[model samples]
Target: MSEHKPYTYVTASIHEGVTRFDVSFCTSEMSAKAFGGDGERPFLTLSSTEAHMTVTTTGGGPVTEQDVTLAREIFTASARYLANCERLHAEQPVNPTDQTTPSGEVAA
Candidate 1:
């Protein structure tokens, strides 16, 4: 039986309310050889903003093109959820007067 290599690496980041994600999954050199010289080399990256999301992926073979449809779909879904949470948080009202304490002292 041929052994399959496990895909590794997934990263996510949130900056300035924007979310970005990257995922890389592919067989190692040894596994590639075991699987008859490379079996579906997958690399995916996704980025999302308040307005939209983008994704890109790479498949097997040295010159193979990346598949980004799945990544984009995932990113869009995540962005929607995050945006909803942000909107809910923003809708909450905070009283400015509550900033000061009763003892004639300002609250930091």
Candidate 2:
């Protein structure tokens, strides 16, 4: 069986001092020989808004198309649950606290 490539897309917006994100993803199924089943048609899945946080403050410049596109990609790829087995993995941690190092760790 051959590995399938996964696709991702993202969208973002700010409202009421909060940042909102949305994401979409799609992937194809491996051949049946890989799963020990009859060959099945490819599949597609989507996930979004698993978790989010408010910006509270803006440093500068208005939102740009690049920012929006990046945000959308982030949200889509990181949704709560994916419908497809072959899916893109979220790069950022679901929780900020989880990303933080221990007190002894130095801040970069």
Runs of candidate 2 exceeding 4 Å displacement:
1-6, 29-108
The lDDT of each candidate is: 0.47, 0.42
Which pairs clash in the backbone of model 2?
10-72, 10-73, 11-72, 23-76, 24-76
TM-score of 2: 0.21
User: For residues 2-39, what per-residue lDDT tens digits would candidate 1 score against the true structure?
Assistant: 55655556688999999998655442221111112255
| Candidate 1 residue 86 C-alpha distance from true site, Å | 0.5
* Cα-based lDDT at residue 6, candidate 2: 70
Where is model 2 poorest over a 10-residue stretch in terms of lDDT? 28-37
Worst 10 residues of 1 by lDDT: 28-37
lDDT leader: 1
lDDT (10s digit) by residue, model 2, range 18-92:
998775444332211111115432222233333222221123345556655765675586463453422322333
RMSD of each: 19.0, 18.4
List of clashing residue pairs for candidate 1: 57-66
